[model samples]
Target: MQITIKVLKGSDCTLEVAPTSTILEVKQQIETELQISAANQKLLLLGRPLNNEQTIASYPNIKEGTKLNLVVMKPCLRDSIQRGFRKHYPEQQAERLTNEFMTDFEKKLNEQSLDDLERFADSIVSRATT
Candidate 1:
């Protein structure tokens, strides 16, 4: 069976493999073809992370012609532009976009002394209520 592998930072490539292939085996093939490390590879199956040990055949949702997207999070110059790319792809999803929208807020909070953060919040509240 044929499948399309889409690498996030790199280019997409085509592969012909059996449906019974293990997720780890597929990852190895991709790493061999792309010359990327396994640790850096993050595969999203229908927008969800795949377990390293899960087999493609085990997932009833995935079939013979399934398209797998392989995303590599190796830091790049573009990452510098965004300050942190985890915003684009959340390090954790439970927070929603609160982390992304408040990127500057987190940065400021981290940079400020604890007393400064309290004072800043106080000033904002005082001005808003007045």
Candidate 2:
């Protein structure tokens, strides 16, 4: 049976897949349509996790016109920070650049008094308004 897949934060699509088609196969098709890697996609119906190796026929909740949400998994905090910095600064030769920066920044923040932290927040707000 055909089904429409809706991504939580991305584009919606459809697949003309059979009820016997494996979930992994569905993910491959999603990867084709959305360009999101299968590793990052999670197809869910009514909050129940779908098994990658299971066929559509295995799930009674999924059928034609059924809306399955695609949730892209987020990397860990360290990976996110590293990726963010790498995306903006390609020339940085440091391997653990974001980790180093975040460690030092966290240390500084922990060392600051509560009043100083409040002032830091105020400064951020002032900068945004200016």
Best-fitting candidate, scored by TM-score: 2
Count backbone overlaps in model 2: 0
Model 1: per-residue Cα lDDT over 2-90, one tens digit each:
77788876588877766678878878888788877576678888899888887777777776567778888765443343445454755
Per-residue error at 89 for model 1, in Å? 36
For each candidate in turn, the TM-score is 0.53, 0.58
Candidate 2 regions with alpha-carbon error over 4 angstroms: 75-130
Give the Å error, residue 76, model 2: 6.0
Expressed as tens digits, the lDDT of each residue in 13-85 for candidate 2 is 9888898999999999998988886877788989877999999999988888898988989766666577678
Look at candidate 2 and tell me the lDDT of residue 68.
92
Q: Model 1 RMSD to the real structure?
A: 11.8
Which sections of candidate 1 miss by over 4 Å?
75-130
